[model samples]
Target: MLKIKNLYVSINKNLIIKGLNLKIKKGEIHIIMGPNGSGKSTLSYIIAGKPKYKIEDGEILFNNKIINNLKPDKISKLGIFLSFQNPVEIDGLSMYNFIKSFIKKKNNNNILKNIYKKCEKLNINKKYLSRYFNLGFSGGEKKKNEILQMLILKPKLTILDEIDSGLDIDSLKNILNNIKQYINKKKKKRSLLIITHYTNIINYIKPNFVHIIYDGKIIKSGNKKLIKKIEKYGYNKFIN
Candidate 1:
């Protein structure tokens, strides 16, 4: 569903992603694990078309079309969803209003019903929906809010960055369950690219491929077994 070829990216004149190549196919779940400052999050931002990051070279193709120059909203409308590591709070906007505006389709009774069901599954209280978007919410609540948006949007390609961070065990399990359900519901029509530092989420959601990235490039590609190895030895051995 998504492909990146020899991607070279930079921010504020400092190179972040260096000649990175990755391909994620439909129905596949790929996890990228790397230490902080390894360019893992940069890859996600680039794919999401964040304007701050300049693509010095290479191309990003989604659904067989080049999207290197597309705006963030355009990329999102093309069925790509990115869950941020830190969700921003907008004091003036309520969660309900934000989501209602985000969804391109009409907001009808059926959509409301489906959204409520997803909220229940994610354990989000109805009252929270009426509150300002991510305003005064705890870390866990912010992450769950991100998942709630994902459930509502139902994008074809899902990119999660550090989704497990700050989530308690129960909340983490709930989020993972929701993600698994989404993938299963879409069958082979959906794809996921998860970037994380720990293997805790991997325990619940099995990835078809696990890639180890270092210094803005993927240095090793393997399967679930790599998760165990990383947990046992950590990323130090994978560096260099």
Candidate 2:
């Protein structure tokens, strides 16, 4: 559903993502792992069409259409949704208000009915509806909000950047359950590009393809077993 070739991105004139490449097939979940400062997050931003990360080279194609120069909302309009690694808390912006506006903007009338069902599955209460977006929310609450958005938007390609970080075990399981259900029970196939540093998240959400990204490029591509090796030996040999 998403393809990146010779991908390069920079911020403030400093190159961060360099010559990265990958392919995400329809209805597949892929994990991108790398050492610190390896440009993993930058690649996600580039694919999701964030302007702050200027692109110097490469091509990002969604559903076979080139999206290299599209604006963020334009890319989102083309069925791409990026869940931030650090979701910001916006005071005075109620969660219900944000979600209703987003659902209207996405024009996902079909998905409207399932919002409450999905929220209940994610353990989000109606009481939390009036709460501002992530304002004073626990780490797990913020992550649950991300999953809620994903469930509501139902984007074709969901790039989850470290959604597992800071989440407790139960909350992680809840988040993964929602994602798995959303991906599996879809009339329109949805794909995922999950960027995470630990394998703990993989147990909840199975990855069809796992890539080891290092030094601004992917050095290894394999199945779920590769993650086990990384958990045991780490990325020293892979990076070397």
Candidate 3:
């Protein structure tokens, strides 16, 4: 569903992603692992059409169409969803209000019912629905809220950047289950590009492919065996 080829990206004139190439087919779950400053997050932002990063070379294609120049909103409307690693808090916008505005045109009673069902599954408190979006939420709360949005939006390609970071064991399991259910609901029509540092989440998600990235390039790619290798020896051997 998403194809990135020879992608060189930079911010403030400093190159961050150099010759990165990745292909995520429809319904495939892919995980990207790398140490800090390896441009993992940069690649996600570029795919989501964040304007701050300039594409110096290569192309990003979504559904076989070039999306290198599309705006973030356009990219989102085209079925690409990115859950932020650090979700920002809006001071006065209630979570309910934010989601209502976000879903856009699907605010009927049935949709509301579905939203509440998702909230229950994600363990989001009913009271949080009235609070300002992400305002004063714990790290785990923010992560759960991201999953809540994912459930509501139902994007074709979900890019979760460290969704497991602050989650506890129970919350992690709940979120992972929700994700698996969602993917199964659509019969392998949804895809995910999960970027995480630890392998704990993978134990639950069971990604179809695991990639080790270093210096803005994928150094190795494998199946589940790669996850076990990274958990054992770390990324040192993958780095030059």
lDDT of 1: 0.92
Model 2, total clashes: 0
Candidate 3: which stretches are off by over 4 Å?
106-108
Ranking by lDDT: 1, 3, 2
Ten contiguous residues with the weakest lDDT in model 1 = 102-111
| Local distance difference test, each candidate | 0.92, 0.86, 0.90
Per-candidate RMSD, Å: 1.2, 2.4, 1.1
Score residue 97 of candidate 2 by CA lDDT: 76
Best by lDDT: 1
What's the distance in Å from true for residue 151, model 2?
0.4
- TM per candidate comes to 0.97, 0.93, 0.97
Native-structure RMSD, model 1:
1.2
Worst 10 residues of 2 by lDDT: 104-113
lDDT of 3 at 46: 93
